[model samples]
Target: MIEESQPGPGETPPALAVSGLAKRFDDVQAVDGADFIVRPGEVFGFLGPNGAGKTTTIKLLTGLARPDAGSIAYFGADFTRRLKAAQHLFGVVADGNNLYPELTGRENLEFCAALYGIGRAEARNRVEELLERFGLDYAAGRRFGGYSRGMGRRLCIAAALVHRPRLLFLDEPTTGIDVPNAREIRRMLAGLAADGTTIFLTTHYIEEAERLCDRVAFIVAGRIVRQAAVEKLLDGARDRRIIELQLDTAPEPLLSALSEHFPTNRWEPRAGKRLRLISTAEIELAPPVAFLAERGAAVLEARRLRPSLEEVFVEVTGLAAERLSAEKGGRRG
Candidate 1:
């Protein structure tokens, strides 16, 4: 239930608002006429394929780059004129290294604290607390140059929160990390959201965003195609049904019978005797399952899978995931 909150005669503005946000670099329109309102203390996800201008939109909001059109208001103030003063209200962590490689992790945190003008004692205490909280206490004395990618990511997040900014920007904060570390990061983010932090995260990891964000904005080719609650997106997806089956033996007759039972379900062969199935947007799994059971077929496993965010991404963009995967591989190569 996203109710629109109208402004009173004298009231504080929204936490953040972007209206007609458009940006261009020469002939390329990186962003186009984007408008959205981010309520305070909400976890917002930015979803887009590669080269879709998601990163560019982040830059415009953070004042790292200017927009050719539209206006951004932060904390009820003009974003351009008050950019410096808003720094205390803004915290950011983007992909790639943003810390000094020569400095130890503790030293890196201290430097950030100094930039935010915290006193030495307070800075030291905060650094220690964050290092412990992020499980980086063991690496606090190690130079960032020697840290693994996951360690670097953890330290970056810790540094971003040193000033306790009300709004946080995270761009692929868990990229290139193992599942355990990524899971920890997700938990930490949920905690922050619980503590009234307004988080805007941009990521290619659909599952991560689906788990962390309350609402998501799906962008394609510099334009927003969808914005809604995570549950709503899943409920609205064109591919919202998946059936899992375990069979005693892999039999063509059984497969044929199952296909005939639900002609609309997309059957996908898996390893062993397992089979995965998909269905159209309008169909429900209950009827299909009952039909199979009545036909005297032994049902091993059947459940509904909410639409994967990746499917939503592909549906909105009309581009296959492999294309984006190839682009990422090319960048690495």
Candidate 2:
């Protein structure tokens, strides 16, 4: 059975719920019948390639654009009908560097507070507090344009939190960040979830979603294909037995022979003289190793491989595994 993000009957109200959501621009249908829900205080990830209606869906949810059809609810209240009344409950940080470049980090946050109708005195305190909380106090006086990519991203998040909203929407929060800095950003987000902040996040990083989200929805070709809790998703794939065999020579020559000898196993020769073996039946180490040894192939390594989020992503989305990193996939998305 397919697990859904919808709350069960008599369950606590969802932080956000979307049903039959759709949108079209000109001749192109950007989002089609999307459905999902975010539980309060949990980090919900929306994952897709570029232009897979991720941005459009965010716009629809944030009230920046209207959907052609569907319903959106926040805490059981109809958000589509009462967006302005519930504005204070939300904070949004766009994917790009929207914070003013010329302004100092502290000043930009203060300005955002003012826009949120925070009192001048309260805004001052909030700005300073956010700077320190985000580890931007040292560069709070520096122009935002001079900040590193990671620092700028943190400040943008701090600006979004100036009003201390309950629900925060973040787009590509860690895109293009260096290793140490990206890790820092992820650590900060985990802390937010711990503090009961509901985060609706859209990102290109599959591993990031697996790490941070309680639940995740995969969007493809402008449609939501699947949604489930991260643990359940991983648990479902845990039983899949995948074995990788490394040899001194390419495994292509052995494919036909292996298929003939072990018809129950699926074999594919990969790059780097490696072969992937998949089977539902038990895989014995002896037969294949002995078979390869007799065929003048040197066996280097043989190990069971764990399934990953990327594998499930490609499976559910029906995208070629090789195209996950390709630009054509983005265009199709």
Candidate 3:
């Protein structure tokens, strides 16, 4: 088991702390000046577009790659000089499989346990327990190479937990998996968080982060753009309301009136007689509705659009999540 730090009076050390972190690969500054603190038992999410240094940040935190400049502290202890000693305090589920393919599912877990110096009898019990916990009991005897993608991912997670780490670093755990399997993994993660495991998750899926993260940090161009509690970000974005209006006539007149009456609001025309109005400040729909009515334009529909985490992400990062995904995909192709 990991040892807890004796924090000073009125001070609680963060589960993980990073300041001014930076890493470079040849010509690229993959991670630059990244900083964040994760409180104990909190599900912290690291979000960014592809090549935005999400993976590099994880590498630095988990000690896979050394940072060019920064201080990394965990539970009030500086782990820079003693990375190996700190290994037992945290676990990592990398983006790709990192297990022996020739071994059976149960054998993989047992091997991981043995590496942690677990006794033979205790390792046997731990392996069995994890197999059941991850829903791999029946397939425990199957070779890992023959397991499905989802099953392999689940077994890898179980192997990471063999030592019961205090901090779990999950790097895109649900990416490329089937929907049902992804849901199961997410459910399991939620249960782990409820039981007080600090999770550090990295993902490109904004909706997944919206549902799972207590706090989220957005990184862009190798730097952290923003970090805040999920609720606070969503609540703050509530001020910026989007209203979509459908009119029988052309939107040129209504668009002009919007500029005259509500100059601060942004108005754009959409296909099929649709006018979208975006306001950074809270405003009633009555004014816009009345303006359109006065212009003899038949108002077919006018409704307020509920703010979503994706909108907030776009507002902060200046790029739509879908566009980012496409760009990443094109580069890969």
Superposed model 3: Cα runs more than 4 Å off: 1-9, 243-277, 281-304, 324-333
How do the residues 1-333 of candidate 1 rate in per-residue lDDT, one tens digit apiece? 222323455656767888789998888889988877676888988877777898899888887888888878887787764566677898999777689999999999999999999999999999999999889999999999999887898899999999889999998777677667778888888988998999999876677778899888877788887777777777767446766666444534456776877787766544556655666755565675565556555557765555676566666666654455345422111
Whose TM-score is greatest here? 2
Q: Supply the TM-score for candidate 2.
A: 0.86
Q: Report, for every candidate in turn, its global Cα lDDT versus the true structure.
A: 0.77, 0.84, 0.84
**lDDT value, candidate 1, whole model:** 0.77
lDDT of 3 by residue, 33-86 (tens): 877888889999888888899888988888888989988888889886566778
Q: TM-scores of the models, in the given order?
A: 0.78, 0.86, 0.81
Query: For model 2, which pairs clash?
Result: none
Over 4 Å off, model 1: 1-12, 243-278, 281-304, 321-333
lDDT of 2 by residue, 175-230 (tens): 76677777888888999889999999997778788889998888887888888998
The candidate with the higher TM-score, 1 or 2, is: 2
TM-score of 3: 0.81
Better of 1 and 3 by lDDT: 3
Where in model 2 is the C-alpha error above 4 Å?
245-263, 266-275, 285-302, 320-333
Clashes of each: 0, 0, 0
